[model samples]
Target: MSERVTPGHSGGLITLGTADALWAGLTNGSAVPTVSAACTCFPADVRAGYVLLGGRVVATVKAGGGQWGVPEMEVRRAAAELNVVKMDHGDLVRIGPFGGAPKQKQNDTAPLRWRQRIARELQELGDVERAAPSEGRLHHLAGIDWRVLVEETRDRTVRAWWLPRAVVRLLDAAEHAETRWLQAARTRQNSTAAAEPPSQRRQIRAAGGRQTTSPHSPTTAPRPYNGELKELLYSALSRKHGISRKVAEWMCAVCRTTPATVLDHCHEHGYVRAPVCQSCNTQERPDHLYSNDIRVASHYTRLFDTHNVDWLRHWHRCPGCRTRTTLPLPHLAAWTAYIACRSLRPTHRAPRGRKPCGVLRVSWTGSQNAPRSCLLTVTVDFCPSGEHRVLAQIPYREAAERFGTWLAETAPAVAAAAGPDRLDGLPTQPRPVIPDTNSDGQALF
Candidate 1:
C-alpha cells in the first residue's frame, strides 16, 4: 500500500540501498509512476540526496563506475513526500515559481509591423504627391513648407501597434519637409537669378585706366586729331578735302607773305605764274567783259517766277557756247516759265506704233488790233508748209496742254524733224544710252 505524505515529511529521505535500487529502475525506464498523466514526475528527494552524496545516476544497461540509478519505490517515496503525483514520460514542467508558462512577449514584432505598414503608406502617399503638378502657390507649399512635420515626428516613440501609422506619418512629413526646403532653396536661387540691371548699367574702366561708356574705346575706334591749329588746317585740306599736301603748304606760304613787298624783295620782280599774283589778276578783271552772252528767243524765255529765279544761276553757261554768262532777272523769269510749260506737256509715244508730228512756231503774222499777237502755228513736221498747221493764239499756260496733245499725236514725225539738228554736232560713232525699263519690260519715262 502507498502512504500519502505532505510537504514537510521527515521520512522523505531515501535509504542508500533503496536509492541504488530506484536509480536502477529509473535508468531502465521501469519506474513509470501512477500520478497525473500530464505531469512530469521524478524522485526529487532521492535525486537531491544522491546529489548531496556526490552520487551520479547511470543506466543499468550501460557499464559505468559512478552510476547510481533510481528505482520505482524511491520515485514513489519522493513523489509522496513532496505531495506531488507521478507523471508520464511526455508531461510538461513549470519553469518559474508560479508553476505556469511565463507570459510570451514579442517586443520587436510590433515595431517590425509598424515599419512595414508605414513604408507601404509612405509609398502610396509619395505616388499621390508625385502625380500632382509642380506649379503655382500650392506647388510652392508642396515643395518647401512640408518638411517640418517629418522632423518633428521622426524619433517619436509610440505604442508598438501604432508604430506603423507613426512611421508612415513621420516619413510623409519628412519627405514633404525635404521637398519644401529644396523648393525654397530653388526659389531663392531663381529670385537671385532673375535680378539683372538695365542694359546701360555703369561706366567701366578700360585696361588703360580710361573710363568709357561707349561700346568701343578710342584705341579700338578711329582716333581724333591731336595737333596745333596750323597742322590741323593742313591735315583737313589734304586728308579730308583730297587736296595735295604740297598745294596746302604752298597756299600757307603765300598767305604768310606780304604780296607786293614780298614780290619786289624776291629775285623775280613780278612772278605772274604764282597763284597769289594770278588770284589778284583774276580779282581785278570785270566778269561781264570776260564772258560771252547769247540771245535766246523771248517766247522761249517766259517760264520763270521770282521764287524759282535762282535756278537760272546754275545754267550760267550757254549750251551753244561754253561761255559763262548771267541772265537778267526778266530773262530768267521768262525762261523758267517757258520750261515749266514744256515740262507739263506729255508727248511720250508707244514703242510698237508710229507716232504723229507736231511743232510750235512763233511767227510775226499780220494783225492790226493786236500787234503783239503772233501767229502760233502748230504743224506736223512731215508737212512743213502751212497746210498742216493748227493755228491758235493761246495763252502760255493754256498752250502747254494743247501742245502736249499735239506732240503726243505727232511724236514720231516731230522727233524725226529734230533728229538731224540734234546729231549735227554729236560724234557719228555709236553712243551708249541707258534706257529705263519697268518690271513689265515697258520703257519708263
Candidate 2:
C-alpha cells in the first residue's frame, strides 16, 4: 500500500511526478493538505508560511493577511527541478504583441511557471521601489528606452513604449498570472458557498438572482483612487488643461452621464485628454498610428488639429441656455438664417437669386472669469467658395439673444426640436469647411 500523507509530515517520500499530480489535484479542489499542512522542514523563504501540498511550494500567506503567491526562490527551485530554462530577452521578444485576450481560443502565450516567476520578482521589486506592481513596470526595469515626443504648446513631453514585442511579452505574462489568481479566488469562493447551510444557500441564491455579474462583466464603478495610483494620477493632472478632483466629480466629458471619476490620458501620446468615467476611459481606444479616419484617429492628431484651427475652442454648457447652443445643425441653421436676413443686399441680387454672403459660424472662444461672460466668435465664409473670415466677437448674452429670438419667431417647431437642457454636439467647435493651410492660429481652449 502507498504511504498516507498527513499534515506537517515529511517522512513520506513523493516523486517529482507524484508532486505534480498532487499539485494538480489540489488546484482542482481535491482533498489535499495544502490548507492545513505547513512546510516546517524547509527554509524560511521557500516555506513562506505556506503548506507545501506535496513537495511543491503553493502560496505565501503574509502577516498582513494577504496572498501574493510563492516566493521567487521557491519558484526558481521549482524551475530548476522541472528543468525549465529561464526566458531571456530574445525569447521574450519572440513572444510578439498581445492584441488582447481572445474570446474563443486561449491567448496565454507565456507559460504559467514563467509568469509566476516574473510576477513574484515584480512584487519583490515593487516592495523596494515603493510603487504598486504592474506589468508596465517591467519595461522600466528592463532599461528599455521609451519614445519621447515634445508638445511645444503644452510645454511638455509625452513618452510611450518604443518596442511592441517587449510590451506583448510583459502583458502576456501578466494576463496569465491574473487569470490564475482569478481562477483560484473563484474556486475558493465556490467552496465557501458550498459549505453554507441549505437555508442560507437558498437565501443567497434568491438575493443574488437579480445579480447577473460575472468575472468578465464590465466594471460599473470607478476604481478607488488611493495609495500609489492616486499619487500618480495627481502628478499626471499637473499637465492637463482644466482637470481636478472637484472637476472629476462632475459629468463625464465622453459619456455625459456617469460621474467623471477617472483622469483619462492618451496611452500612445501620454498627454491628458479629459475627465471621464472608468468605463469611458477603458472604452476610448486611440489609434497608436495617426491614421486618416477622423472618428477614431489618434489623440495626437486631434490635439494637433485643435491647435491648427482658427475658430475652434473648448465646448461647455452655455450659461444662458444651459445647453451647447454653438454647433448643432438646427442652431447653426437658425444662426445662418438670422445672419443672412441681417446682411441682406436687395440691390446686389443676381439672376440665380440672392445668396447673402456665406454661412455665419458661431463658436465659443473662451469664458471671462471676472465678468462671468462667454466670448462668442462669429466667422463668415463668403459665397460660392471662400475661407471663414472673422465677422465679429460678442458676449454670451448677445449670442443667446440672436439664437433665442430666431427660435422664438419660429416658435413651437424649432423650440421643441432644440430640447430643453440639451447637451448635444461634439465636444469641440464645428470644423471649418475650408482647411486653414497656415498653422499660425491661436491655441484652442
lDDT of 2 at 12: 35
lDDT per residue (tens digit) for residues 1-445 in model 2: 2222334544333432333333333333321112111222211121112222222333443323332233434333432332321222221121101223122322222222232333343334432234342442322211111111101121144211112222333333223333333344455446656898645542111121211112221212223232222212234566667555444434455445445555543221223345554334433232221111111222222222322121111111221122433332223322433342345322225689755555444445333221145555555544455444655665655655565554445343434434346343322333322211222111111
- Candidate 1: where are CA atoms >4 Å away? 1-360, 366-380, 383-387, 395-445
Candidate 2 deviant stretches above 4 angstroms: 1-373, 376-392, 398-445
Error (Å) of candidate 2 at residue 375 is: 2.5
lDDT of 1 at 355: 34
The pairs that clash in candidate 2 are none
In model 1, which range of ten residues has the least summed lDDT? 262-271
Model 1 lDDT per residue over 1-445, tens place? 2223334543344333444343333333322221121011121122111111111111111114643333334344433332321323221111111112233343311211222333343344453334343332121111111221221122253111111212222222223222233333345434544674544343333222322232111111112211212212121332444232222223212222211110100111111112121122112111111011112222232123332222222122121111112122222222323342344322425586733334323222322123244222222222323245433334333333443343334343432222123323322332121122211111110
Whole-model lDDT, candidate 1? 0.25
Clashes within 3 Å, all models in order: 32, 0
Highest lDDT: which candidate?
Answer: 2
